[model samples]
Target chain A: MQDPFELSPSECEALLRAGVVGRIALATPTGPHIVPVNYSVVEESIVVLTSPYSLLGTHGRDSMLAFEIDQFDYEYHRGWSVVARGRAEVVTDPAEVERIRKTWPPRPWASGIRTLCLRIRWSELSGRRLGTGWQPMEDLPVHRVV
Target chain B: MQDPFELSPSECEALLRAGVVGRIALATPTGPHIVPVNYSVVEESIVVLTSPYSLLGTHGRDSMLAFEIDQFDYEYHRGWSVVARGRAEVVTDPAEVERIRKTWPPRPWASGIRTLCLRIRWSELSGRRLGTGWQPMEDLPVHRVV
Candidate 1:
């Protein structure tokens, strides 16, 4: 197996954009929590819709959060992981909401009210890929939605 | 689409035992971080091997952590997520290590000197599955290894 290599900033952003689902990690009073949600990258920030009472909607507001997206092949023993660290902001402003809506708005798979919208603006971004001579973006399981 | 339903405790334990990889969430001085790892279930505790200087090994030492394992199908819009919340303890006792080694020991796919063994004894466990009338265990991407 080839040694893993670091992904550049542009590569990480492209992967995030191509991906639809990502996991968000945050510190809650009880302990740390990780929740998977379908997201859309708008203006380089990760955006998602969740119920106001959900764990993410309740504790993720205005908190430093980590977002991760990855794809792995167990048989081939190859994969890539990208992690973004940033503060979470609840999108409430009408103007900001309009801007996000114009872009690829997030659509939650699970049925719910999902009125709350959270946007994470990452300050730190990094990624690493294992194995060799392959483009992860090309191997995405789902095609990128326009 | 059917409303998601909560999985019973026994069902959650079965899913965790069958899963080979899981994501661990922990709080660090910088922020909340999530790292994907291959793990094994021994005595209902999540055991993983990570590099000593890695994020999980360093920040997870003796800290409250959250572990999540899931499988999602984009086409069917169905999936299940199981989250385990517990305190992470580094395994150092020789006798305890021997006991764990006798069970399904964690084998990390990533190449590294993963000398640190961390065990998470969950105090809280919960899971939910979207969609209905399908067996997730049967749909597992990889067969469980003994």
Candidate 2:
């Protein structure tokens, strides 16, 4: 694939490690709505916590899931999107959670216990970005601009 | 209402008229997701082009919808959020859309007629903003950041 956003594996890991904030994507009966989540980065996977009543907990966990984390520099017109696609499930055992908690601590948002951590386990993790050195907008024809 | 960042009716009209890109939120089967959509202000509402299979069309149109447009200066921490809360419906009549097309042209992203323009009837519109003061992170506790 002649993809422009060719980022190195280490670079991908760095962006994933940058922070725990990301947008959780899923479908609901009424429609799709997005919410910010404070996440924990664990062994090549992104984990999020939610309660049973949470929409995601209701529709997603144990179902197909994807987690996206990115950073954008507007002045430079460059950004990268890294998504992990896999299954989501509820973590019920406290001992298992305690074992994972030492390394990946669960953080809370203003939202609500509806927080169930989703683990996206996939190896096809990669990213794309808009590089520099584009011609100025002034050089384009009126029709081209359109 | 001691609202700090309220825009006048005309200002709100202009914001929608300016054709600033708006964020579209849709509920997906996996979870809720958000993406950028180019739109124009029409007849006191915000409109965007979407496909029939698009999440919004499948689960959102004619259902409760929420559209948000924001102008934020991250460096300055002074910005505004305009939220449109209402139901969305697909425009079926050609004449009503023809009236809309005169001002708001449709620029479809993907190639397909399955994608139609959705008019977000936002009768309950409201806005709020952050002040231009440098409130140190230290001054406010973690729970107050929200």
Q: Please tell me which predicted candidate would have the highest lDDT against the true structure.
A: 1
Candidate 2, residue B71: Cα displacement in angstroms equals 9.4
User: Cα RMSD (Å) per model?
Assistant: 1.3, 10.4
| Interface RMSD, prediction 1 | 1.6
Residue-level error in angstroms, candidate 2, position A78: 4.8
> Which portions of model 2 show Cα errors greater than 4 Å?
A1-13, A72-78, A111-115, A122-127, A131-146, B1-34, B40-46, B49-146
lDDT, candidate 1, B1-146, per-residue tens? 44788989998999999878789999999889999898999997999998889988889989999999988888887889899999999999999999999977887777888889999999999998999879878888886677
Q: Write the per-residue lDDT of candidate 2 for residues A22-106, one digit (tens) a residue.
A: 6565555544444345567777777777777766678767665556655443334344556555666677678767766887764
Q: Determine which window of 10 residues in candidate 1 chain B has minimal summed lDDT.
A: B137-146
Task: TM-score chain B for all models.
Answer: 0.96, 0.74
Candidate 1: clashing pairs of residues: none
lDDT of 2 by residue, B76-124 (tens): 3344545565677888789978888887664433234544778878766
DockQ for each candidate? 0.68, 0.15
Candidate 2 chain A lDDT trough over 10 residues, lowest sum: A137-146
